[model samples]
Target chain A: MNTHRPWKLSVAGWAALLLFAPATVLAHQEIGQITGFASGFLHPISGFDHVLAMVAVGLWGAVLGSPAIWVLPVAFPVTMAFGGLMGLLGVPLPGIEIGIAASAIVLGIMVLAQLRPPLWAAAILVAFFAIFHGYAHGKELPEGASALLYSFGFVVATGLLHLVGILLGEAHRWAVGRQAVRAAGGGVALAGLFFLWQAVAA
Target chain B: MRRAVGTTLVALAAIVVASPAHAHLVETGFGAFYDGIAHFAVSLADMLIVIALALFAGLRGTRAARHAMFALPAAWLVGGALGALWPTASIWPVSTTLSLALTGALVALDAKLSDASVTAFVIVAGALYGFVNGATMTPGGAGGLALLGAVCAIFFVNTILAAEVTVLPVGWPRIAVRVAGSWIAATGMLMLGWLARPTLA
Candidate 1:
């Protein structure tokens, strides 16, 4: 490989730039404190970890096909609401961060492996992670927050991500699309590994 | 060369450092108007009704479907005005669910209603949803804006559905539309079952 060819050299340079960037900085950027409906909506989207895990759930659901397509998405938000409520009520659950990280890793692998668990099992898997995600939000809920409105914001955001997953997973209906979906799974799995590393290191 | 390298490094740092750890509920300056739209958007029941209505209109074809586009907005606005002005003490609580079931069933059957019948269905559906929206609206400017947003959403959704269905050719795509109707109907029935469970218990 000619290191000096313009396109190749630029690609190498870009790869180097990514590799050299500090994990902390590469992981997330601070956008200052946001609150209210926008805050709730932005919450899931802002975090790389949350985005990876939630999208992974959708991708897996799509891959699993019918019933699961709708089932997982529905189960997640409802169960997540329950988790959020638990947080609001000051109920304690252990290893919430670990669980969240594990979600990304496990769900990513599930997509990567093309696992087709029974619909109930898949629902249970995503629903379990949704709690921690919800709890994280619930615990940090702003003072004087309207529970109803805040819940609405996050639920919509989560739903949109799932929709993305389902839409992308629809690619499976095509041969080329199948490979792309699997590649996306691999990418998510890699991100999950990164999150796991970050979690363990912390 | 050194300066270019520095610039690249700076950009990369900016990207990495800007990421946040997790989502939290934060303030949005949108206020009640956005809230109304948000409420409508997230209301699964409301959306389901709109989708079913749209699917029905699409199946009904051009002349019949146009009635829905016209009648629905007019009725919705009229009903909204009534609800806002009179401020009903209680609404038909099951109206939404029932609307879903009725429309879903219609879609599932892929029934071809007479133009008048289709017109009647559109008006009734429009009035019911609009009334709900109006009743939910807060007083004054925000309320007015909210009503506007609701009408826009409803009009937009109905227009899109009615238009798209007319254009969709017969075959698998059309069949898929009917299948969607079946799913919507199934969901409504499931909801009804849940609602009925309390009585059964």
Candidate 2:
């Protein structure tokens, strides 16, 4: 019936274990799967341009509403796959960096202005941008272990970025929140301009 | 009573960790029957393809899902049996990735497919997977029991996933599932691209 707070008990127990327990053993061997998955998952979200554009895709989709909300998400991956194939086959597309940065600017503008184009046109635009992103990432190979699992993590991370944008875009349903969404769009566009400059400078 | 319960638990644990007697079973450190289950469960390519197909069927509505539930495992079993008897090397990665991409693409699109079409799709996918899985996991006629375990695994995954998606309401939840499909498709496509990656000089 007598009880200290649960947090206190946990803290005491952890302290006792830390002070009394033997030093932890570190593994000497390389953990292949961990490295593979980490590399794959990081690739899409790692770059500034990549993350911004992907999020913008979802943001634009959400602002568009209904089928575009879903269609853009759908089209992006499938079209990206085709672009990946082209890259793998050694088909060259010029100005990949320019394309990637331009995606952020265009899509961010769409979000900022609440530009609602026809669904087909919107889908094509997103799909077109997806190609550049895919080609940029297409040549990357997981570091020789759990390659398939690596792809799973990579794709999931990319999709999660879209989910984040969609969740954020939900703010547009309200008046004040709409302003916030627009502000976020402005920030994205600014970032895109920076990226575009870097691409051109290089 | 406590000692008896403890002893029983220990015995079950021992049984679970016991080395397999059959050579056909994949050595997953889980015993013979579980090895077959592990074969189905552990391989992302096989498992995700089944998942994508089940999801696609489910999105098509209850009728298509119902057809998938039976068609998938049944075709898998028949194909597995054939493969077990006529075992060959299963070179799966490229083919598996392509198939997974197609199946996931179907789900991502939220395609409206008929019951018959769904049945055929699942049957083809299930049988092809079963053949490769059976060839790889079980070597010969002696591995019938393990093959049964694999079939059961397929049935269980298909049933649960398809059932859940069938009952999902027509909005955000459904959209979330479609998102999952796109992820699967993207992953599969990425793997395919990896196959053609430029070799370092």
Candidate 3:
């Protein structure tokens, strides 16, 4: 028995490897449908719209500074979930697409304007947009995917974007950096205006 | 002031330019099975992104700003619940435009208010936003969540970058803000024009 121990261990290792080999292969067979962690990670990052908006949330928060800085960021996601549930429930909302585009335009302008809203007012405005945004999300869930995992991945990415915005905004405390950051906002707003035009035309 | 105005004008211009291409993504004629899966992936991704943005901000030593960051997701949850419960579709042009206008005004106001006031304002505003979202969602299978997520992500990122970066000369930030505002107003005008196109045609 003692003599066989080393050989047995090797056999066990081989068996373990063999046991898991097929699972890896099987994982690859499924395509197009996001089934695992990787897909979850890729989904949010894959879309340009998603990346831009997530980062924008953080940037705006940082620029607003303090309460608005915090309020607006929180208002967006929380309200978005509510909108998602509505989409899931099969309710009909007219002009949702238009609303979504308008949100981009409006929010972009606010950031550029550096609008300093009262906390209550800011929350109210953001919540309104959140509904439409959430509904858009809920309406796009894929089948048989782990909702929790997917949510986890996207949320993490969104937070990172916000951090990026915050960092950029903080840099503005310096003279040159401040000008640079504001200009970036202007550039993005220009992009958004372009998008808005496209949305309206369509 | 000039920088702010300039930023607003630029943003508005972008919106007007981009509006036509900013169509919402919709899945058509798919079975419940497929659609359901799509919905799940999209919603999860959307919500996760929101949370992630907040978390990221929190981690970057903006600990003081965490409340509003956390409030965003919470507001969404509340708003989503409201939307699920009371689903309705109304034009609400005045309400919608007013909200945007108000936000713009507030951004400008922040320049004047004390930091403490800004904090308080954000919390209350965040909750109000949560309520509005909660009350606006459809009941089933409309892809509202995905749309909301996509839009939020888009605007949030764009605004953040725009506010933080300077594409023009040193004296352009304030001008840029006003430009963005004008651009937004222009997009609104364009939207109105598009709405009117059928009658004119």
In model 3, the Cα lDDT at residue A66 comes to 70
Candidate 1, residues A104-162, lDDT tens digits: the string is 88888888888998888898999899889877766666654333234445666877788
Worst 10-residue lDDT window for candidate 2 chain A reads A20-29
Q: How much is A113 displaced in model 1, in angstroms?
A: 34
Once fitted onto the true fold, the runs of candidate 3 whose alpha carbons sit more than 4 angstroms away are A1-37, B1-201
**What residue pairs are clashing in model 2?**
none
Off by over 4 Å in 2: A1-31, B1-30, B139-142, B198-201
Cα lDDT tens digits for candidate 3, A85-124 = 5655546777665566566566666666777677687678
In lDDT terms, which candidate is top?
Answer: 2
lDDT of 1 by residue, B12-54 (tens): 6665665442322224336655555665676656676777888
Candidate number that wins on TM-score, 2 or 3: 2
lDDT on C-alpha atoms for all candidate structures: 0.71, 0.79, 0.48
Q: Tell me the interface RMSD of every candidate, in Å.
A: 11.4, 11.6, 25.6
Model 2 C-alpha lDDT per residue in residues A12-74, reported as the tens digit of each score? 455444443334332222356667677778888889888989888888888998978878877
Which residue runs does candidate 1 get wrong by more than 4 Å?
A: A1-202, B1-4, B12-28, B31-35, B86-88, B139-142, B199-201
List the candidate numbers ranked by DockQ, top first: 2, 1, 3
